[model samples]
Target: MSSDASSPLAEPAPAAGGGGRLVLGCTPIGNPGDASPRLLAALAGADVVAAEDTRRLHRLCAALGVTPAGRVTSYHEHNEDTRTADLVAAVQAGHTVLLVTDAGMPSVSDPGYRLVRACGEAGLAVTALPGPSAVLTALALSGLPSDRFAFEGFAPRKPGERARAFAGLADERRTLVFFESPHRTAATLQAMAEGFGAERPAAVCRELTKTYEEVVRAPLGELAAWAAEREVRGEVCLVVAGAPAATGGDADPAALVREVLLRVEDGERLKDAAAAVAQRSGVAKRELYDLAVRRRAE
Candidate 1:
């Protein structure tokens, strides 16, 4: 907080306007104790609450000892697109609409993005009540490099496609974070191991900031096996180490050339097959393609 004489914090509060406002409130990602006092006041004072799930919002409000002063309209995945104009209209009409989601900040892999964008387009003041974020939480706990990181959301759902996607990131030097579903986590880890190699260190953070939260640090292969038999629950975020720079002593280039030729032999298209081989072997596609042509000609 700046100590200037005319600082905004020191300015007298303005009266609630008749035809303007929206509050993009941030709720606790997990623990109720994580809720900031500003969030509590926002919920209690807003004229309308547009939440991802009204029941969940109610539960949160109950835990915080806040009985909302106005109605809560559902603003979620199924209806956010259609509901944006109406919600924006309410704000234009002077209703202070409060937005929240199941976890973390809404609009981040959540539904409030559209509404927030709409409000911005319509010249309404937009601000956040910043609070807990799982992405930051998981990264801090993962024991991976955090000075620079990439959030890729989630991996592709298909098995082979997912592997190819991971393979593309095999050269990324920055730590990578991702969101994963409970059911698909095992397959995700397996694909990651295949891409980054089973030896790459990674962490699986589950139910972050909650009572049952867990963080497992191990090689991707070990995590994959650990996930196979368990009924993993809650939201999961994974932190994966970026690919290590190659030294002089990796697998022989002749063996890699042989592998590329084999994929082509198995009815994979020259173009598609070349990409997959390039991903797996960390060899440039052009180099592999030249070797591929030479092998085929012979």
Candidate 2:
């Protein structure tokens, strides 16, 4: 669930056309018991199955006692674009095209995005069989503030880009959830510790809902060191705590106000300048920005 005001991806126009043939079925993120009747029905009735991993699809169907009568086509990140048209066409022609990802919802961080976008654009009926999602699951287990959070699917592979990415999110007051590969988990955790601070509390959830699952709760620095020393296998979810609360009572409000105003005089946006002062002085943005303006006038 992206909170972007104009989320082009989250919502779909399911009534446009296509004779209600295109189906987006969500498999369980973890527990097989999470599987829904809709998912089983879709598996049994689809005319064509576009799966991120065909083998996993086979196993999933086997677990649910569903023998798919549809042609299973590979529709993963590597081949989603090329195959979207064919899948959509089949649905538009009144064939039930079921889209399943390796796990979880299709479009959040998977191959179903292209096909869904294509269906939305084509005025085709794009219904969903919602079941489970790792993003919401981890957020629930994190025990962090969940009123607002952002899901950054995966961080950049390169270090510099990753640094800038974390810097941009430094002032975010809401909890942040992200997925990372086990192979690069150490690198990612190290960078997070560096960018978000080694002391920030975080939870490393691994192989969520699967057997042999592990959840490590600790400060970012400890986790970073722990991650580097060993091999981490399975899906990884990093739930990092939000920025620390302000320590406004320890500082001279008047003096801090003067300095913040000077920086705003240098042409920074009010919101951004306010955020900067908040991070540096541990002052509330609302109070600092208001004082900055008052000091500027006086």
Per-residue accuracy of model 2 over 134-196 as CA lDDT, tens digit each: 998888887778898989999999877786677666557889999999998999999888777
Q: Give candidate 1 misplaced runs (Cα > 4 Å).
A: 1-15, 246-287, 290-298
Model 2 stretches astray by more than 4 angstroms: 1-18, 245-298
For model 1, residues 91-143, the per-residue Cα lDDT tens digits are: 77767777889888988888888888899999986678999999999999999
Q: Give the TM-score of candidate 1.
A: 0.81
Query: For model 2, what is the alpha-carbon lDDT of residue 112?
Result: 80
The stretch of ten residues in a row with the least summed lDDT in candidate 2 is 1-10
What CA RMSD would candidate 2 show?
Answer: 8.9
Superposed Cα deviation of residue 82, candidate 2 (Å): 1.7
How does each model score on lDDT?
0.79, 0.77
